[model samples]
Target chain A: MTAIGKVSLRDTVFQRGRSKERSKLLVFNHTVLLLLTAFAVIPLAVLLFNSLKTELDIGQNPLGPPRTIVIENFREAWEEGDFAITMRNSVIYVVATITAELVLGGLAAYALARKRPPGSDLLMLYFLVASTIPVWMYIVPLFVQMRMMKMLGTFHGLIIIYIAGNAPLTIFLLRSYMIDLPSELEDAARVDGANEFQVLTRIVLPLTKPGFLTVGLVVGLGVWNEYTLALTFIHDPNRFPVTTSFAKFVDRFDTNWALTSAGAIIILFPVMVLFLALQRQFIEGLAEGGIKT
Target chain B: MAVLTQQKPTTVIEKLSDEIWRKKFLRNVIIPWVFIAPLLIIHIFVVAIPAVQGVYMSMTDWGGINPNVNFIGLDNYHELLFEDKSFGKSLNNNIVWMLFFLTVPFILALFCASMLAQIKRGGMLYRSILFIPYVLASVVTTTIWKNLLNPKDGIVAASARALGIEGFEVAFLGRTDTALMSIAFIDNWHFWGFLMILFLAAMQAIPPVLYDAAKIDGANRWQEFRHVTLPGIRPIVLFMFMMVAIWSFLAFDYIWLITQGGPGGASEVIATQLYKNAFQRFEAGYAAAQGVVISIFAGFIIMIFVMLRRRGWDI
Candidate 1:
């Protein structure tokens, strides 16, 4: 009985020591994460702070919180940066690109995942190879082609390119998602006299809604944040998306810290909101899509 | 009339079977292609054809818009190889960018991701916060950093002055010496979190049993990471290394947005130089050559990794 008591006492001591070490490790991890969090967040906070500060206030306190909030920067930036038109254009591009990309990519993904037509493997291989081809490899010729086709400087033209650029990613992601789903339900729908298209619509679409959502969010964010293509294709100032337009705005108003800061915030606002709300989807989808693309 | 009527029944059976065969063929074969056609066609039109044409374009002296075009085979490549000083500088800068990304982000991300992987509580918050910068547009990210790094009245200057750090208030983005590295730093600030998140996800996917086994074997924290965590996440780590390496050559948006390869071409990467050549200088053929060179570099890197994988490196 005395030996048993001693062993139990020793066990408690070891357990306590282990717990202490674990907590120490946890504390260290938290500290590093906190510092990194500050590293990641502080610059953005500075931008936000500067956006709220007046010009004179920003000069005095560039990185600190504002002494007095100023609302004029937003108004000034909105007008001078042409946020009204550019943001609207970006919205149209994001929505249209996501819509078309989903429809086309979903159909293609469904076929690739389920139907597996003649030469489907070859088609898949083509996309896999094509997806790896960088935009730099083709941009110059694509520009010429766009010009020849009279698609340059047009919204639909840019949107079409966006859809095409995102197609491989959408197809791959949605195909992976669809492949996991049970084929039994689709078979049942087919047996119930549903044609292929009807089966896709009534059965497959409902089941694969999450996949679509993820693809849509990923593709839409890409379109919203796209820079190179928009800069190359859309030269018309009125047709410029928020990215290229904001780039030009910053160039013209480089010294106007408050105005530029506010413009930056405005451009980031929608994305920030969507990300905060659907962060799981955004993070997972982007992580997957980014790796593949 | 009686013999023709008897043959009609057999003909009906043959036609019915033929119809069934046709319907089965349509459902099984043609329909899927129909489904795949639209996006595939768009992709071909936008990417595949242009990519093919770019190779031929590289051999020509088509000055973007001029009706007169002539094939000057290999001249563009020859100039890029021997004569073009700017191209040399840009290619060298791309190498620098690649090396920086290959080292700094990998170390930072691997360390932080392993640290985060150890913590269960508040890991999500840290991840989401860290990833916020990645979600922002390149324009916004560059703007935020540019303002913060502004030599005059920017935070860095202000803080340097407050700390009495003399000569630390120089315009990082405006100077030739510091421009490329500085832009890389800014790009990294917006990028490393993404790598961290990727690493973190990979780390989380690693089996807990291997970690347990390492612990049972009396592995120290570093040993545990080295033996268990590292190998477990090797595939993702190696894949991302290749990707980051490829993307380094294609690095354009951040550099273009911030410096436009400026302060006297100190940060002139191939992509930015190619952009200027194609759009501004209207040397479309030369730009096409540059583009082809960039793609070849990317492809070569991919090939090396693939070759290693095929040779059973397990990477």
Candidate 2:
């Protein structure tokens, strides 16, 4: 009893000493993390602050908080940047690309998973090689080819490109998701005389709603933020999506910090809202899709 | 298909015959291909055919405009390698970039991830905040930083003036010496946080008992981390290393957005070079060669990792 009490007392004493050391480490750890968090966040705060500042204020105080909020900058930016047309354009691209990509990719993923179609391995091999081919490798010929087909500088052209570009990723993610589903329900549906398409839509699709959602979100976000393809194929400003249009706007308004800042904020608002609402999925999906720029 | 399958008799012989038909030409071949054809056709037209055309075009003197393209085998590759000093410089810059990305983000992420992993409370807040930059578009990120780094009316000069620090108001993205590094720094700001979140996730997956055992062994935090945490996350760390290395070659958008590989070709990477060649300079053949070179580097990295795996490395 005496020995056990002695050991307990020693452990408590050691823990007490460790607490002092740990307290110091905790401060150090948090200070470093706090600094990094600021590094990531402060510039964004500055953009928001500058967006509300006048040119006079921005010229005088580059990154300081606004003395008075200038919500008019958003209005000004909206008009001048042509964000009305551009945002609508971006929505079209996002909606069409996501819908087409999900439908096509979902069907392919379904075939790869359930159907185990003949030559599935060959298809997998093709995508594995295709995914590794840099866009630069194909951009020139693709441009020439698009022009040949009269698909360049058109919305359908851009949408077709986006749908194809996104297929490999969508197939890879959704196929893995579909593969894990139990075969019993599918077997029962088949036994009950469900056709292949019916089995897919009724039993498989509903069961894999989360998979579809993930593919939709990933493809939607990619199409929305896409720059290089849009920059290349959609040369007409009338058809410019928000990103390419915003880039041009920022360049033209180089000195108009308030306007450009407002533009940046407007471009990011939808993404921010969606991200906060779906933080987990966004993080996980991006982590998995880290190969993308 | 299912209707035909459903009409089968219960006899094993009948069921066997039906299963054979279903597994063969009907179920396995025709029906599956019907479902797969749409996506396959799209991919073939958009990616495969163009890619094959690109390879063939790379060996020619195609200026991207004229219908006449002359085949000149190995000339584009020869010129890119021997005559293009800018290619070498850009290649050097890419190397510097790969080095920067492979180290800076890894360190920052490891440090921040380790620190965040220690704190249970408010960890989510810090992570979410750190990850915000990653979610922002490249245009927005570049725009935000360009203004911040602008010489006369930017945060750098303004803050320096506020603090009475003189002679630090140089143009970061304008000067040749600073341009590539500046773009890299901006890209890292948007990138490291994502790395932090990823590393933190891997760290979280590490068994707590490992830490407990390390503590019982009188191992300090550094020792514990070096011995346990590093090994625990080796696969993810190495995988990210390979990914960052591959991505460094393809680094574009930010550099293109900010500088367009200019202010005297200071920040020209392969992709930017390829873009300018195809669109601006109309050197389609040369640009295709550059693309092939970039892919070769990326493929080489993949090959190394694959070979390492073949050699029984856990990664």
Candidate maximizing lDDT: 1
Docking class of 2: acceptable
lDDT of 2 by residue, B1-315 (tens): 668856947899988887787667776678888888999999999999998888888999999998889999999999999999889988998999999999999999998888888775687788888899988889999999999899896878778978999986989999999999999999999889888888888888877767767878999889988998889888889999998998899999999999999889899888988898889999899888888888889999999999999999998
lDDT of 1 at A93: 98
**Each model's interface RMSD (Å)?**
6.7, 6.3
- TM-score values for chain B across all models: 0.95, 0.92
Instruction: Please give the CA lDDT of all the candidate structures.
Output: 0.90, 0.88
Q: Which ten residues in a row have the lowest lDDT in candidate 1 chain A?
A: A1-10
Give one digit per residue, the lDDT tens place, for model 1 in A195-266.
Answer: 999988898899899999999999999899999999999999999999999999999998889999999999
- Candidate 2 — which pairs collide? none
- What tier of docking accuracy does candidate 1 attain? medium
Recovered native contacts, candidate 1: 0.79
Clashes of each: 0, 0
